[model samples]
Target: MNTSAPDEGRIDTEVRGHLLLITINRPAKRNGFTPAMYRQLAAAYTRLDDEPALRVGVLMAAGDHFTAGLDLPTFAPLMQRGEQAAPAGGVEPTEPGMAGYRRRQKPVVVAVKGITYTLGIELMLAADVVVAADNCRFSQLEVKRGIMATGGATLRMAERAGAGNALLHLLTGDEFGAAEALRLNFVQKVVPPAQVEQETLQIAEQIAQQAPLAVVATRLNVLKAIEHGPLAAMEEFEATQQRLSRSEDAAEGVRSFVERRPAKFTGR
Candidate 1:
């Protein structure tokens, strides 16, 4: 449950019911990620995707801030050397496509507050859903550091927020508040700081309560639609529906509806 990386930072993981709660625990440095921390986080995500019992993942941070960004002093040299973000034998946390890391099959919900810069923004953008505190501050300051965001920010930001909105922050490297983030469609919900984690956990729990196969399939379909086009995703709808229809969970769903009781899905 307590997975520590090198340096003083660490990633703590806790499985609550069907949810994997991943907390970044390096508050002393505003939760800035070192290489080791990144690897540890990736390992946690790998567990979530590989474990059948784990239906959803909730990513949050300890202390006041989600993260300040990568430990640039340590990372910039690697960047200059033309090295990949994820080192050898480790999965890339932000962008799965980079370095051929296995794409995550599960959904991740992110809860953020205070200063969330650079990789923090990319992390949330890569996730399925996000909950932010009203006082949250976000910035894609990679350009300011004389580097570019390779952590799916350049690709997913425009997809999530419009091109204009994404460029406004990405190009300028200016700080934006939680309200602007909501307007840009970056975060799904904005609540008081005290309620951020609770709200995120509730949403993750809601997703976890659904049939796991259905949830995973739905996410895959939506992502495919985004990437390949709606028609392509729609073409697979019949086949996907038929597959689910044959599942034991589907039978349980029908029985529960007929019996006027809640469905108890075993992810079958």
Candidate 2:
């Protein structure tokens, strides 16, 4: 399905089976995100969560580069006014205190290539899994631009890439290659440029094939464990297990296992 945001057409959306394919379309500017672009991207993500048919989302770019980060010139006025930009039609991708506000109950995978700067890196970090092209270059250059990385980078970077490694790049605003990103755990996988999208889609498809409720529960459990403590996560274990056990999909799962056939989950 074609799900283009209302204005500018900066973000493109396509539905393939249960996967929502969201592509950054402003390649001419190396996918630099203007305010309109951010709104469109946020709208797509919100649609993914709101639509029950969409079990997973794959975020990739249309051009060689994933994104050049924010268009600082266009955003300078908002920054000067100390105002947070709001999305035009969807949930805000970043909240006041939450890190990675785009993280929905459903899973999201990201594929990146070429120059991924500032917000680009943060977007990757926000995703459940990342696939980076060999030619991908990443940098959190906000500090160099006399601004700080506010798009969940400060909160999520250390958690994903270790405090020392995150600071090394954040402090210096230096560019790093895909290999470095992999080593730092910034990216989950690295493939050739030609295969980045394919690989990402494959992973998203695999996740989409699973029972949607179980998949969402698993992701939520992990996030709860990370954001809260193990004790807090454990608190939900019994309740969640009991709830799922009574679900129709859970019964189907057991019956399918007994029949030695692939389970057809209905997201019950």
Candidate 3:
């Protein structure tokens, strides 16, 4: 643990090569987020956004369970005070019960294991890719708790898993195994518990090896397409290509790709 950057009891970050791995470390509590911890996630995402050295970021949890949900006890005070539209320092929490609202640009991969309830289930929708253990359970239990999903889930859940299934899960707040989640596109890949992290990291490593500028531009276009329409996304896509095609890195990518070598991108 780095005493220099102590972050209460929520997250632990380790930078591995060009990949930044942020683990929800309160596994003893099933990785629930404290209000302070919730606030830090957005700050961390902001750091990830500006860091040119990192091409990929990851969000995962330790132990068998991914997360039970927010630390209601710790955050209940904030709730009693009423949820602010955004966090005080402008780093706002991860969109209130939603995941993935704090970040975009770089591709993010989530590795899931064990039980995932509430925010944990919603979190998968936020990542570009998800690799999960076969044994993991997925659920949306906020309705059962007399709460609604405050995360991006309310919007993206139907898009991710089809409206029928999303309604079933959200309305009933039942738990289902990873096989169902995989079938519904909630997770991109499912493997044994032993290989989930390895596979996820490998996927991230491959993403990190691509041309940095092009990668981020691709992410932006894809996210724009998701939020807007294909026509609008296409407009940005053309401009992105036109802008990138003229850069030195563009030529380098082709040269290195043809030479079967790593492209030393200056991010030009």
lDDT digits (tens) for residues 22-44 of candidate 1: 99998889999987778789899
What is the overall TM-score of model 1 with all chains considered together?
Answer: 0.95
On lDDT, the candidate that comes out on top is 1
**TM-score, every prediction:** 0.95, 0.93, 0.89
* lDDT by residue for model 2 (1-268), tens: 3433333438888899999998888777888888888877788889989999999989998768999999888889988997666543345654324433454678889999999998898888878899999999899988899999988888788887789988999999999999999998889999999999999999998898888999999999998898898999999999999999999999999999999998999899
Over 4 Å off, model 1: 1-7, 85-91
Looking at model 1, report the run of 10 residues with the lowest lDDT sum: 84-93
**Each model's backbone clash number:** 0, 0, 1
Candidate 2, residue 109: CA error in Å?
0.6
Per-residue error (Å), model 1, residue 10: 1.1
- TM-score-better candidate, 1 vs 3: 1
lDDT per residue as tens, model 3, 175-255: 899889888888889899999999999999998887888888888788778778888898886678899999899999899
Once fitted onto the true fold, the runs of candidate 2 whose alpha carbons sit more than 4 angstroms away are: 1-9, 88-90, 94-103
Candidate 1 total steric clashes: 0
Strongest candidate by TM-score: 1
Q: List lDDT for all candidates, in order.
A: 0.89, 0.85, 0.76
